[model samples]
Target: MPEPLGDDLVLLFAALASTTQAEITAALADAGYGDLRPSDGYLVQHLQHGPVSIGDLAGKLGITAQGVSKTVIEMERKGYVSRTPAPEDQRTRLVDLTEKGWAAIYATRRARAHVNRELRAALGSGASAFLDQVRHLAENSGALAALSERRLRP
Candidate 1:
């Protein structure tokens, strides 16, 4: 059997990712984004690329249309997203990230970088190899493919 340290890599990865997320969330709150829910970050990240129809967002998120609409509505009210009538279908509306939403995305990226800095500081010269190995393992195990298909769930 492997050593105890290698026995629960999944749990270790999860705990570390959760802690990093908490740090990012706290930074967002301090940046005046306390109104965002835990799951809202997933939606915000998904919308970063461009506008998408409600149905498309639902499909990408694996949720119902109404659920996506409710999320979009709340985010719209908070200035994170705006909906407009789609050019092709006036009956369908497209949700686009607002300037505020983009700012949140940038802020989150900076927060993650800060977390990485901490990792580097803690792990020193081993940090790069450590991260590369983690990714290598995830890819080999097919976790990356699954995650890319559905995205992360906060």
Candidate 2:
């Protein structure tokens, strides 16, 4: 028997995610969007497709509705997100990303791409297989549903 990855996959992925997050943070700061946090990008991923209710977001994020509301308030203050009354129901409020939020999204994408390219270049052909295997595992484990459903979580 042989181990191909040499160590635990969880640690590897965590390190990679952290590095990419740092790059994203620095990139956003460089682009004049210092108010955004790396975690903020993940939190608002539901808004990428369209608006979502705070209750729905709470359920999706595994947090309380009150927590979601507080987060939305902070994000709105930071200019990354906005809350509006749902037209269909006056009692419901919907959350969506603002123009500034979109810029952070782009920055995150660019930073992740840069890291991917760097790893690909360093790993040569093995990088593709490694990535493919990771994706395959993610899909089989139901983890990829978040990506397909336009959801992002920790």
The numbered model that scores best in TM-score is 1
Each candidate: RMSD to true structure? 2.4, 3.1
**Which lDDT values do the candidates have, in the order given?**
0.85, 0.82
Residues 10-62, model 1: lDDT tens digits: 77887887898899889888888888777987677677678899999888888
lDDT of the structure predicted as candidate 2: 0.82
lDDT of 2 at 148: 78
Q: Which stretches of candidate 2 lie over 4 Å from their true place?
A: 1-6, 150-152
Output the lDDT of residue 17, model 2.
Answer: 75
Query: What digit string (tens of lDDT, one per residue) describes model 2 on residues 67-129?
Result: 889889999998988999999998999999989888778877887788778879988979889
Error of 2 at 83 (Å): 1.3
lDDT assessment of candidate 1: 0.85
Candidate 1 clashes between residue pairs 3 or more apart in a chain or in different chains: none
Weakest lDDT window of 10 consecutive positions for candidate 1: 145-154
Residue 116, model 2: lDDT of 76
